[model samples]
Target: MDVELKSLTGNGTWSVVSLPKDKKPVGCKWVYKIKRNPDGTVERFKARLVAKGFTQQEGVDFIDTFSPVAKLVTVKLLLALAATQKWSLTQMDVTNAFLHGDLEEEIYMSLPPGYTDTSSGSLPPRPVSSNDTAAEEALKILLRSHFKIKDLGPLKFFLGLEIARSSQGISVSQRKYCLELISDTGLIGSKPVTVPLDPNVSSHKETGPTLVDLTPYRALVGPHMKAAQRVVRYLKSNPGQGLFYSVNSDMQLKAFGDADWAQCPETRRSVSGFCVFLGSSLISWKAKKQHTVSRSSTEAEYRALANTTCCAPDKGGEKDCGADFSKGHDRFKSSERCLLLDGDDVAYTEWF
Candidate 1:
């Protein structure tokens, strides 16, 4: 706590000032977390001071609530590219990163606990060139000059994903995350299951008695706590099973999309499912219920294809492949490049 206070004070995060008559300062709290290694060992304890921004009114307290974040697809794409290209990957964390940014709103925050001063709390890297050690060091020094950061060395575990690089390629998984989740759900001694959810229980079984109090099952699991436990058991069966971005893989981007018409009993909406691959590595996949209803199976399949096309962006010097269902939808037929395979026939379809 003292270390955090010193960092906040030394960085000039806030200046003591008299409270304005028309303003009600937001409260602040200290959050603590125990950082652990992949082996479930203690790495360090982290402390962060944050403001209760939820109490402030929108537009009046802040106009924009946007915060930059890397998309999961983008992250997966980067990992795939790095593995295929055999590029070096590193990870670093900026200490008090949120404190380095400047605020635009004239908002105030209550004094931090145990502090006598008045202040307000507000909430707020690019890739380096390859094989250039001197350039990387220079970039690190430049960043350190402006803000406090810790160079944690090579990337191993980040965002609950464990990354391991080998001569073959890169392996990404969430072994530790899965174990923690299983332990939290008291499924440590539970027998592992082959499938995530039991088909018989989900389809044939009647609805169980209503769970009036959902407090026990609310934290991590949902109302279907048994189903969640089944998933955990399945994860326990092969916890380390994850995507392997092989070095021998190519840069080709292939996508397969399909949909089931009227799959949902209540909504009668089609469920679209798609999986995108960068070479042999599965970079992205999703199964989502379509917003609107589709009249026919062909329409549902077309909607699924459209969703897949939006996710599969064109890359330079890379071929794009999409599953060729039928020619019911000519709207996607154009004079562009696309690898379409319908049965034994392999041809180029229009790329949108």
Candidate 2:
């Protein structure tokens, strides 16, 4: 595909622009990728010219780098909802996503190799004049006016989520990518474990001999995370998996939360976990460490419960007003209340 420059003003024309005196233009590079199907067939070849965003400065080049992304739970919930509602799910991709975002800051980027105006032919470099600020602003306006960008349209691929739409519902899968990761790590031939972690065992603060070679550990953790993410992909693989909703049940939203006290031996911080369900189907779940240190298991459980309770849409941020008790009794009371509310149908367990 050929890159065309359009006048930002909607009129067709090219304009010469000057560069800023203080700011250095970041470099750009072209990335190439080959799209393939699960059946080992080539789908298409794609190329993207991207800016080196890493080189950007925080205050000068840009601020507020935070970008909101749909959480994993959100993604899974959407999928489950689609399956339950029997609605079709489709996937589309925007060819160049970053290019669509309007540049907010006065940023300069290096001209792509072989795409620069070579006719300017080894022109002598000129020193910045006294009125450099005004010149820079005028230059930016001219550059934006000359280079017209085209939106590649809808999104077909995102991250690694492959989407497929059908009459039953939308299926998201990443079998191809998952298999590639498995193969890359030589884990394809390894035995498959039933659980992501060993429930009986716990990780403790190890003050003993440290790993002499950290490379292997980094490699191991890297692939493991990739596999966990691929769980979403596998779900997509079988878009028809058993997430269907039935008209026979009430759509009550329920949640189960628990915590392990002093779970991190080094930090003495508890690990909190919670799962939310719409009817019998789990819609959201989380397992994470508490930000603050808890004095006891009971306190940890209480804190975890508070965190889980906040997940409820109606519950605004409110401090727990219940009376306090001794460590043992408080923990028992917390667990008892949690179980009583959840009943035998739902399972929530906590231990220190």
Off by over 4 Å in 1: 116-129, 199-206, 215-225, 314-352
Q: Write the per-residue lDDT of candidate 2 for residues 1-352, one digit (tens) a residue.
A: 1232221112212233567787688887766666665555897665545679998877767777754465555555555444454433333222233344555666666765555442111111111112245664464456445533222222233355554545554455565665665565555545555445555654453523466766644755632344443433443343333333342323445667788888876788999987776555565678888999988676787777777766642222111211111111111124654444543332344433
> How many clashes in each structure?
1, 11
What is candidate 1's lDDT per residue for 1-352, written digit by digit as tens? 7777777788787888899898899998998878788889998787777889889877778887756776667667777777766667767667666666678878788888887531212221233323457777887899889866677777787777888889998899999988888887788999999998776665212456566867656865542667766888999998888989998877666777777789876678998887887778888888898999998777777778778777764542132221222222112322122223223243335443
Q: Candidate 2: which stretches are off by over 4 Å?
A: 1-16, 20-23, 38-40, 95-97, 116-159, 162-174, 205-216, 219-250, 312-334, 337-352
Best by TM-score: 1
